[model samples]
Target: MEETINLKELFQILRKRLLMILAVTFTAVLASAIVSFYFITPIYQSSTQILVNQKKADNSIVQYNEVQTNVQLVNTYSIIIKSPAILDQVKKQLNLDMSVQELTNKINVASEKDSQVFSVTVQDAKPELAKDIANTTAAVFKEEVAKIMSVDNVSILSIAEVAKEQSPIKPQPMLNIAIAFVVGLMVSVGLAFLLEYLDNTIKREQDIEKILELPVLGVVTKMEEKKAAAAAVTKVREQTIGS
Candidate 1:
């Protein structure tokens, strides 16, 4: 025989185990909150902006050629910004403990396609350190590029400023907590149903009869009310006789 579960039964099971599900969800959410607020450190970001332009000051020529030149040279600037020649000077000026490679890894250089403007960003746990790194790197990169290329094509448009607001990149509490809660709920509900199925031992008489391939002799109510009452009466009589 095939066995099938109905919606009503499912609803009943869920309702009965609702407390367990809620407990799991609350636990997951609380754990996320605790880790995010107390255990995780916040990260801060600082950025510097630079304008890239052709060495020639004359704008009479078609702007298209200048745009192409700027785009082609942007990759060179990005690499130069991370090179040891620039980063080593920055480290010396700032008296930083990190090596050139470490500083380079912290810096991010990006520019738009066919655009004359680009930005360099740095991130660190300390807000002021992030701002200082960005500004110093940009200034050093501008100076070094001018000295080497013998052209003043790169110029600092904006120096990085310390951010008033702090934002962390890691350990997103709300998102993590929500995911944990959902996963915990699914696991708890699955375990609940599994245990319930495994622990059920009482079998219907009809099922037993079918399995045995025999007819049932009779059905007994197994009532205990009469026997219980007679025992109570006999106890009362014994008490009265003793009195």
Candidate 2:
């Protein structure tokens, strides 16, 4: 015979194991909070924007063709900013101990769509270091691009500044705890169902009837030891008083 469960049984199962579920959920949330706050390193980001426009002669108005050319060159400049040529110079200028690859990993360059403006962002453990790296990278790239491509078009629009109050971009404690809470609830519920399924002990007459395909003829009532002893003493007292 096949067995089926209903909503009532599901609720009963959860009710029976509610304490275990809550314990697991609380444990997961606590572990996530601890790890997020203590173990992970915090990263700080600083960014500077640079404009790629052609250097025209004295008081010359910008032309549409020149704007289009600068827009197209933004992509090339973005890639060049992370290259060894620019990164090596940035490392030397900053007196950084990291290699070209390590420095490249810390820097990112991006441009606005269909625009000649691009930004260089740097991330480091120190907020001041991040600001310095961003500004220095833009300066070094601007100076080197002119020599490398023979185009004096790169200009710094803004330099990154150290923030008075900064926050890390990674290891969000609340988000991590929320995710762990969800995972813990799922695992705990799954384990509850698995334990219920594995338990084969008959708990009621209905269970016995279902398993054996037989009707229950009778059921023996259970009696507590104290109640049975009291009843026996009363019967003996009544017999002695009648005799």
TM-score of each: 0.73, 0.84
The lDDT values for all models are 0.82, 0.91
Candidate 1 Cα lDDT to native: 0.82
Each candidate structure's count of clashing pairs: 0, 0
Which digits, one per residue and each the tens of the lDDT, describe model 2 over residues 7-98? 77889899999999999889989999999999989898999999999888898898999899999999999999999998888888889999
* C-alpha lDDT of residue 176 in model 2: 96
Task: Mark the regions of model 2 whose C-alpha exceeds 4 Å error after superposition.
Answer: 1-5, 57-61, 221-243
Model 1 has how many clashing residue pairs? 0
Q: RMSD in angstroms, all models?
A: 5.3, 3.6
Per-residue CA lDDT of model 1 for 32-109, tens digit only, reads: 889887898877788999888855656666578777888788888888888899999999999999988888888999
Candidate 1 error regions (>4 Å): 1-5, 165-172, 190-243
Among these predictions, the greatest TM-score belongs to 2
lDDT of 2 at 144: 90
